[model samples]
Target: MGNAIGMVEFTSIARGIETSDYMIKAANVELLKSSTVCPGKYIVLIGGTTGDVKVSMSVGEKYGGEYLVDTLMIPNIHSQLIPAICLTNQVENPGAVGVLEFYSIASAITAGDVAAKAANITLIEIKIGYSIGGKGVVVLTGDVGAVLTAVEAAKKQCELLLQTTVIPKPSPKLYETLL
Candidate 1:
């Protein structure tokens, strides 16, 4: 994992694969994730130094061409973002949760990174693509002020914000179901 993260989403899986290959070959970036998203889209996530990530995204965008759906390069992504997106960590009984919903996985990921870096919040989950019909959602928790600040940061990064909510305190059952 690195402070910088780059991602590209493509409308065509074939183009996405091709772009990813070019991107990896062109830069010293590590490929974090590359998979088919819901609604037949494809996404590639890479991590490295800011310069490397930027170089990779440039190559990706060039190869993506007309198939490109979205792209992002975060120079100082939050430390907790990748883990939450990968679903490899858990936070028990988080407080004052906030949710940000977007129309695309790439958008959600970009916004989530911004949110996480903006406040001292814990990223609970980043659900995207599959089973959600191409939509994406970011869930985070902290004190009410932190959650609100994070959500606002995310909103600034997101173009198609479908929904956003802040729950100061959720019921036990709701926490059980969501977390």
Candidate 2:
């Protein structure tokens, strides 16, 4: 079997690790909180591969409604993190390394549910929607192809509702530009 990619979003990166892990966790929390607490703004986006992760936030509301809550925050975090959890059969073995980008949690989860059902993939969990255009994450594993396909599908499905430009997870091809 190959690795799998899981996507997630959070209102604020409040999921704290241990004290020693505070450095990285702090940056995530700060980044997530700054974006989500904007009262009303674009969402955050995140995507991750087996050993890699990405993080980003949306510009503003281009999806639906004027303002959105951060309901999917915690659940996205759980869902994205759950795969690695189950894979290792441990709550926090190597932990889940993921990338977050600016995508609709509602869109991602809704599409994810459909994808999971159709593909026989298990859903780790789900949560309500909040903090529109705030924060999102994608976790990838297994075969790079499968993970890439899943990411494309999720974004394509979400584009129907969301109208903002999405920055794809940086790959080697884009590493130079990203740098």
Best by lDDT: 1
Candidate 1 minimal-lDDT segment of 10 residues: 84-93
lDDT of each: 0.87, 0.32
- Per-model tally of clashing residue pairs: 0, 48
Residue-level lDDT of model 2, residues 1-179, one tens digit each, is 11222223233233211111332232232222222323243334233332322211121112222333332322223243334323322222111122224445545444443334333223322222344333333333223344445445655655333332223343545433222
Once superposed on the true structure, which residue ranges of model 1 sit more than 4 Å away at CA? none
Against the hidden true structure, what lDDT does model 2 obtain? 0.32
TM-score of each: 0.90, 0.30
